[model samples]
Target: MELTDNLKRVKKPDWLRVKLPTGKEYVKVRGIVSEHKLHTICESGNCPNMGECWGAGTATFMILGNICTRSCGFCAVATGKPKPADWDEPKRIAYSVKLMGVKHCVITSVDRDDLKDGGSIIWAETIKEIRAISPETKFECLIPDFAGKWENLQRIIDVKPDIVSHNIETVRRLTAQVRIQAKYDRSLEVLKRLDEADVKTKCGLMVGLGETEEEIYETINDLSNVKCDVLTIGQYLQPTPKHIPVAKFVHPDDFKKYREYALGKGFRFVESGPLVRSSYHAEKHIF
Candidate 1:
C-alpha cells in the first residue's frame, strides 16, 4: 500500500473527463438555483456529472448554508464557523424544487456541529415543506452524522424522506485521515439507526485513497451487517493539492467488479464507477 510521489501526480484518465455544463435545460436549472439562492453539492463539490445531471433537469440541493463546521480532508466544501441557520430555508428550498419541476430531488448539507441539534430541526422542516409544496416529488437526503446524537437523527427519521444517505466517505483505515473529526463507527451507527427506523438507508464510499481491496470488502461487509440498502463507490479525486491525494485511479473494469460484488452482498442498488458519486443517478435508488 505504499504510494510513490509520482503516483500522486498521475494524469487523470480519459474516462474521467466530462463535458462542461451547457444546454437550455442546464441553464434553466442553474437559473432556478441562482434565483433561489440555494447551494448544490454538484457545484460545491466540483462534481464531474454536474453537466449531465443539470442538463437533464435534475440537481441536488444543499441546505443549511455553504460553510461547514467540520474540515474533512476529502471534501471541497468550505470549513469554518458557519452562520446562523436560516429558519426560512425550508420554504425557499420547497419553492425552488417546485420551480425546477424536479420529480426526484436530493438534499444534502454541510456538517453543522456548531448547532446543538446539529441542524436536524431545519432538516425536518425542509422535508415537510417539500412534501407540502411538491407532494408527488420523491426525496433523498444525504445527511450528516449529527455527531452520533440519536435525538437529532430521529428528527430526520420522523420527517421520513424516501431514501436517506450518509456517506462513510472512505475505508475504515482512512476514515480518520479523510474525515478528521468524524468517526468511522459512528457513521455505521447512523446508518444502522436509519435502517432500524425502517428507513431505506444508503451509504457511499470513495476508493483510490490508499485502501486495499480487502479493506473495501471489509467496509462493504460492515455496511451489509447493518442492513444498508444502497451503496455507491466512486474513485477519489483530490479536490486540491491541500486535500488528500488520490493513491490510484481505479479502472472501470475494477469498478464493475465492485458493483457486482456489492450486489451479491445484498445491496439493493449499487452505483460504482470512476465518476459515480453519492447523488449521481440518485433518483433511480428511490425504489
Candidate 2:
C-alpha cells in the first residue's frame, strides 16, 4: 500500500485516555516559568500531555528561542526570523530547576539555522549552567541536527549532557515530506556522533505520518546500526489542519508489539505508545 494511502481514522483506544489536569505543584511550576519569561516545548509545541508533565514537576525547556527557522510540516512552532540567543536564559533555567526541586531535566529547542553554529554554543552554555546550579540534576539535550555538520555536533558533545537526542522525526521515505531540509542519514549520523562520544544517545520517530510498516522496521534497523541506546515511538497528532495530515493512528496494542520488537533488537530503553514523546517519563526510563 502507498504510504499516504494509509490515511484511515481509527478510534483512540482506552489506553490513550489520561487524567485531566489538577495539581498545586503544577501551578507553582507554571508561575515560576512565567516569572522568568521562559518558553517551554510543553506550551509552545502544543504537547498533548503538558498538564500531566507539569503536574509531575517537569518541563522540557525550549531554549535558543521559540521561533524556528525551518517550517517542518509536522510541527507547530512558528516559522520566522528567530531572535538572538538569550545569554541569561541558561542561568534562569538553572534557577528554575533548582526551585522546582527537579531531579532531572529535558531541554529541547527549535531549529536555529539563523545562527552561525546552529545554536550549539547556546545549548552547551545552557547545559553548563544547569550543571553548575543543580549539580545533582541529570540533563538530556534534544537537539537539532545542526544542519548535519560534524563540527556543530561536536560543539554540543563537549558539554557532556547525560543523554543527547536527535529525532529522525519520520522514516526515511517520508523524511522529505515530514521535515524541512532534514536528511534521514544526517540524523542517524547525529545519533552516531553521540554514540561515538561515549555518551548515551536517544532517537525518536512519529508513527502514523504515512510511513509503511516495512519503513518503520527499516528505520528501527537503521537506528540500531548506529548503536542508539534509547528510542521513543509515538502517534502523530496533526497540530493543525494545514500541517501534515495524520494518515493512521496505530493501536496501543501494536505500539506494545513495536516496543517489544525494538527491545529485542537491543535498544537499552524503548518507549512506545499513543502518548509517548521523546521526553515523556524520561527520568524514570533513563536509569
Candidate 3:
C-alpha cells in the first residue's frame, strides 16, 4: 500500500485516549525533572500515553540530549548538531528516578553520531548512576546503533543493562526510504552483535509504512534469527506532515494476533499494539 496516499489525520481511537491522574509520585517526578532542567522524549515526542505512564509512576528517560544527528523520517526528534555531552546528566537522571520512586526505568537517547563514542560512555554512566541510586529498580536501555561502531556498542554492553534495545524502525524493504542515514544491514548487524555479546536484546518495528504482512513476518524471522529476546510492534503515526505518513492503522485485534504470532515465534516478550513503544508499560512486563 502507498503510505503517502493514506496520509490523513484520523482521530485517535477511544482506547488510545488515556486519562491523566494526579498523585504524589507524579508531582514529585515532574518537580524533579523541572529542577534538573532535563528533557524526556516521553514529553518531547508527544507520546499520547505520557500522562497515564507518568501518573502511574513510570517514565522513559531520554539521555544524550534532545537534538539528534540523523534525520530519520519517522522520528519526531529534531535533528541538528547536538550540544556537548553533560557530565552531570547521569547524576541528575538518577535523582529524578529516585524522586519518582520508579520501579522500572527505560533510558534511551537521540542519535549522537557527532560524538566519538556515539555517546556510549554517557549511556554506560547513566546506567551505572541509575543503578547506584535505585538498586532495586529494573533498567532497560533503548540505545542507538552507534552508527554501527563496535567501540561505542561495547561501552554500553559493559554496563550490562537488563535489556539493550536498538529499533530497526521499519521493514527491510522500506529501510532506505523511511530511515535517512541508517542502513538495514547495519541494523541487523547491531542485533547480531548484541546476540553475540549475550545481552538480552530487543528490537522494534513500525507498521503502516507501506510494508506488507509478509515483510513484517520476515522482520520477525530476522529478529528471531538474531536471537532478540523482546519484540515491540506498533502502528506508525506520522509525527508531522513533512515526515513519512502512515498507511493504515492496524486494529487492536490485529495487534493481538501479531503479539501471538511473535510469541509463537519464540520472542521472550512481545509488546504489540498501535500505542506500544519500546518502553511503554515496561515495568509491568519485565517482572
Query: What tens-digit string does per-residue lDDT give for candidate 1 at 1-287?
Result: 42323334868898998888999999999998888899999999989899999999999989999999998888899999999999999999999999888899999999999999999999999999999989999989999999988999999999889999999988898888789899999999999999989999999999998999999999999999999999999999988887777888999999999999999999999999999999989999988
User: Comparing 2 and 3 by TM-score, which wins?
Assistant: 2
C-alpha positional error of residue 224 in candidate 1 after TM-score superposition, expressed in Å: 0.7
| Model 2: per-residue Cα lDDT at residue 1 | 49
C-alpha lDDT score of every prediction, in listed order: 0.92, 0.86, 0.83
Q: Candidate 2, residues 1-287: lDDT per residue as tens digits?
A: 43334445555657667676679978987898899888999888788888889998989999988899998988989999988888888888888889889998899999988888998888888888888989999978899999877788898888888888889989988888788589999999888878888989898889988778888889999999999999999998877666776787788888998899899999999999898998888896565
Q: Between candidates 1 and 3, which one is better according to TM-score?
A: 1
> TM per model?
0.97, 0.95, 0.93
Ten-residue region with minimum lDDT total, candidate 1:
1-10
- Say which prediction, candidate 2 or candidate 3, comes out ahead on lDDT: 2
Residue pairs with backbone atoms closer than 3 Å in model 1 (clashes):
none
Ranking by TM-score: 1, 2, 3
Off by over 4 Å in 2: 1-15
Clashing pairs in 2: none
lDDT ranking, high to low:
1, 2, 3
Residue 207 lDDT (model 1): 95
